[model samples]
Target: MRTLCSSTLIGEALLIMFAGLVAMKLTDVGTGTIWAVSGVAILLCVLLCGAITRPGAVWVGWALQLGVLASGLVLPTMYAFGVVFGALWWCSVHYGRKIDEFKAQRAAAEQAAPAAA
Candidate 1:
């Protein structure tokens, strides 16, 4: 969970930076304002990486996804990006848990084999 989630978050941080750069060139929004919002969003992405193991962190990730979708009002392209990244986030959490469960079962099986021997 941690590994996949952290990777997704890092990807989001990079994408947010790219979006900020594009917004600066294409929109009337102030540079400081754009960067400030982008900075906070990217910061949250980074911070959430560390919190991925904690309770409610998944909800936070969903909120971030919605925020990205909302950004489409400012930059129309963001709606597509939002959906793509949201799917990635879902896969990370879903398959990551499956992987974790598999690892746990493997470990338990190994332990039981040793005991049986």
Candidate 2:
């Protein structure tokens, strides 16, 4: 879960930076406002990577997803980016959990096998 989630977040950070560049060119908002938002969001992504396994971290990721989606208001291109990354987030969480469970199950089975021998 950590690995998958972190990967998604790191990718998001890059996307957000790229979107910031687009916003700078295409929007009326001050460069400061654009970069500030982008900077905070990028920071959140990096920070979230470390805390991915912690309690409530996934919820924060969900909130960040929504925030990214909202970035569409600043630049329409972000709507597509937001959705794509959102799906990536969901897949990472979903499949990562399954992978973790499988690993645990395998470890238990292996342990039990030795005991049975």
Candidate 3:
């Protein structure tokens, strides 16, 4: 589940960045800089999510995510989007732990069952 959550967060980040870029281009809002910056931020979130998710990288990922959220404030829409992304990050963190626990239990059960047989 942690892996799934990580993938989901990464997917969301990519989707948001792509959508924002496309919208800015189509609307000609002259906010190219905004979109570009957001895209980079989201990309960083993707990396952070992946990193922290792997046990030892948690602090780094958390810090980077916070930075991304803070930087998103320049645009209200981006800020909202950042909040959603942050939620994903939280879910990934918590869910990943639970998933790891379940996997460990399942592995233990499997090993025990074979021995019992």
Candidate 4:
């Protein structure tokens, strides 16, 4: 779960950086605001990666997604990008949990087989 989620977050961080650059090129928004927003997004990404094992971290992850979506207020293009990344985040969490469950089941089965032998 941690591994998969972290991988998705790394992708998200890259996207945020790209969005920042694109916004710089396309929007009338000041460079300072763009930098601040991008910096916050990147910082949240780092926090998400580090806090994977901590309690309530999932909520923080969700908040970060909301922040991404909110960036659309500054750069309208971010609305589309935010939705795309939001779906990706959902997949990462949902499928990542499934993968973790499968690993646990496989480990349990292996242990049981050894015990039976």
Q: Local distance difference test, per candidate?
A: 0.96, 0.96, 0.65, 0.87
| Model 3 lDDT tens row, 15-73 | 56775665566554568675776667577757755565466566655565565566544
The weakest ten consecutive residues by lDDT in model 3 span 68-77
Quote each prediction's TM-score: 0.97, 0.97, 0.64, 0.91
Clashing pairs in 1: none
> In candidate 2, which residue ranges exceed 4 Å CA deviation?
none
The global Cα lDDT (0 to 1) of model 4 is 0.87
Better of 1 and 4 by TM-score: 1
TM-score of 2: 0.97
> After TM-score superposition, what is the CA distance of residue 38 in candidate 2 from its true location, in Å?
0.4
Q: How many angstroms is residue 6 displaced in model 2 relative to the true structure, after the best TM-score fit? A: 0.8
- State candidate 3's TM-score: 0.64
Worst 10 residues of 1 by lDDT: 66-75
Looking at model 4, report the run of 10 residues with the lowest lDDT sum: 50-59
lDDT of candidate model 2 versus the reference: 0.96
> In candidate 2, which residue pairs get closer than 3 Å at backbone N, Cα or C atoms, i.e. clash?
none
Model 2 scores worst on lDDT over the 10 consecutive residues at 73-82
Query: lDDT by residue for model 4 over 1-117, one digit each (tens)?
Result: 798789878988998998899899899989899999799889899878988768888778888888889989978887887898888888888888899899999999999998999
What are the per-residue Cα lDDT tens digits for candidate 2 across 1-117?
999999999999999999999899999999999999999999999999999999999999999999999999989889898999999999999999999999999999999998999
